[model samples]
Target chain A: MPGVKKVGQRTIQFANPPVVMATASIVGPKEGEGPLADCFDKIVQDTYYGEKTWEKAETKMLAEAVEMVIKKAGLQTGDIDYLFAGDLLNQTISANYAARQLAIPFFGLYGACSTMYEGTILASILVDGGFAEKVVAATSSHHNTAERQYRYPTELGSQRPMTAQWTVTGAGAMLIAKEGSGPRITHATVGKVVDQGIKDPNDMGAAMAPAAADTIITHLQDTGRKPEDYDLIVTGDLATVGKALVEKLTQQQNIDLSKNYTDCGILIYDPSQDVHAGGSGCACSAVVTCSYLLEEMIAGKYKRILGVGTGALMSPCSCQQGDSIPGIGHAVVFEMS
Target chain B: MGANEGSLLDKQFQQVKKQAQQQQYQQMAQSVKPKQTWVKNAVAAFLVGGSITAFAQIIQNIFQSAGLAQKEAGTATLMIMVFLGAFFTGLGIYDNLGKFAGAGSIVPITGFANSIVSPALEFKREGFVYGVAAKMFTIAGPVLVYGFVTSVIIGLIAYFFQ
Candidate 1:
């Protein structure tokens, strides 16, 4: 465990690994029709989910997801040491307001789509370092809320080009305990911002592919592992195009990801469902990892897996100011118990 | 179209299929893109702009026939055109016309009136002074400043020549 302290650059080896006690996911109707629909804990039929606004619906989703995760873990709200949550809203409003109701020590994060894994790394760090006994890492995003804020209003009826990705309307929460019988967090590799001079806001896959590839390469080098080392390697939200780009980039580095690599963005929804370029949102990785991947691990389908959460760091105002989108990826290795 | 997590072979097959579909979408996007019709837009602008000028001419002639001087008639015609423009904009009819006519409606004196009253109407809910009055020149503010400054400079040049 001594050499496990630090791998190559940007990688960390936790001496005392944290365990995922329980996780839960809640998604809207559009996501309910996806391939991973059966994995979700709850699926609301309406975008508003009985709330007056999309933001409120997202807040409701995250709060309910947190409650579900704690209940599934058989832990009371007071038992949790800290709550780490975030969303796509400005000021991380959904997670912040949800935390207000949960009343736990909170850490608000904004890593765009990478928020789930980012929260995972932070929560694991706190638990592994003896800073906390238990922490909840969660993130959520509503399609309508993200659409109006990031692009045109729903009323505008704007025709999104093929390069445009559908923002996921869902929330996922995970309870990381100091010690538990679940998937063990082995190592984490945090990514740096990688900008490939991509300025088009529509082609998010292209913007984020480089970051995912960078983190994956660094993870492999630091951990002294290859593409085939793990049972599976998954990315956060780099759907079809971005996934292909990652495969190509890794291939150039003499790594073959064609066998065991998949992306959450591409896995959640079916292509025939008309989700162009697949799904992209803070909840993409969160929901997929919590619901689908965790269940598979529990079923003994995957023994060891790596999750690379990728995020596009660009705001609508920044894009209008002609700023290029920079992307980041954070990786966490999970081993089944 | 389908990604299977259980079987590695199926996952690889799905990824390969996904790559092919992506290429198809890229090509489709390029082929189906709407082309900008510059010549058509130019004709529309010219016709609508010229028709607006002709209407102003007719108004000027009527005022002249009523014993007004040429300069006074011209100024009165411009005022009438601006009033008509603001009136149509307030009725919400000008925006519809703009959608249909494109640059045709946007190249007219009505478009100038729209430049002033549209933002005012949109922001009127915020309050009168800070909202409507303040934003009244949101679109026209640059026009007024640049228009007056250029005209003053040209006037000085003309006076010096004289």
Candidate 2:
């Protein structure tokens, strides 16, 4: 059957839909504190698991976040049709454990710091495709947890340079539904992972800012949108160091997101709040998107939002082997209609 | 009745006098002869203080060998030094070290780590506002301010030269 013959009386149309529903964020330790300050510190601390694997910490964080998101969405454990999640761990154990507890059909994803955007994009696609009525997308990371798993244990007494970011120990979850009254995820621009082969992990802000700028500029170009079109453009975990670099580099392309752009890494922790410089982690972007940004959107404070998640694609092993650090970023747009 | 009361008071006074005499004798017998002078104590403090930096270097070597980058290795070394310094500080050992070494512990890259982490951990104790919030940027404030100013100046100079 020809295409026109198969749908003689049907027509296709494109419309921007509203996000019908969203939910709460749950974090460890104190509300404004790092996760290591909590009970998990004791659970994972002084143990072989705490000293060896980040998987345990990621699992604990995701379990807590998923529980909160599911309860808030008024859905039961079995109600979710699919689970899309990611983290910075080797096998993405955060998503794995969350899937085990939630018992939803699962797809594990990884984009390093950009995991949240990757999950959100997939969730939106699932909803738009009519493949699922409800999908839960979540991501999380812990500083001590990731450190022990990915780098060194606390007992090892490793020193941190001025350029190194204190990985934020936290998690964030969001429930994306096909029929919701909240702001719809209108469009997403997938970024090509770019590597300038910068080697220093201590100066990650400089390493990743160029990739962030590339994605932001290209997203605007593809969508035929200008910076002024959105109220704010938020980037994932650039911290104070990266935030400055991003602003400076973007100006070279005549694309200035600085006036409206803010970094999740900087906003998550008040430097004066004793968090040292700013926040970094998959959770940095996730929590800010679900809690801070979502709240602002609901209040009519912002009509349109652009969230760009950036990741530095360098592993401890990779860096140690004298390999260059490649950078990657993904941009997703959400609008209220 | 008056005769009996006077005898009772005399008995109590006699008992107190015997107790004081016994205490004095015990103190005299227990006292030890002094061996080392104040100079020895000061010298001991110096040795202990200097050892911490040496220990930190040992740790840095291990980190370097383990495949950490130079900056990362340096940071790890500094963290160990700061921790050792703080430990000594808590034990009142660092005070003596600070006096004797006089920035020996404070002058190295490790000293930089101590300067940042100590204030941060201290402010963290005061509660979020005065503690974490107020002190979060306590150490990094100067670095950031100076960094920003210097970068701008450099950028402007470069632009003008061009």
Cα lDDT computed for each candidate against the true fold: 0.86, 0.67
Candidate 1, residues B10-118, lDDT tens digits: the string is 7788988866754653453344333445676567667766777788899999999999999999889889998988898888777665644566666667777877787
How is the predicted docking of candidate 2 categorized under the CAPRI scheme?
incorrect
User: What total of clashing residue pairs does each candidate reach?
Assistant: 1, 15
Which tens-of-lDDT digit does each residue in A175-284 have in candidate 1? 99988899989899999998766677888887898899999999999889998889999999988778888887788799999999999988989999777788999999
Reference-based TM-score of each model = 0.71, 0.63
iRMS, candidate 1, in Å: value is: 8.0
Q: How far out, in Å, is residue A92 in model 1? A: 0.7
lDDT per residue as tens, model 2, B1-162: 998999999999987886574354223212321222356545644674467667777887899899998899988777676666556444444333443444455455444544555454534434767855676555456876998999999999999998
Clashing pairs in 1: A8-A222
- Top DockQ hit: 1
Q: After superposition, how far is residue A264 of candidate 2 from its true place, in Å?
A: 0.4
Give the interface RMSD of each candidate: 8.0, 24.9
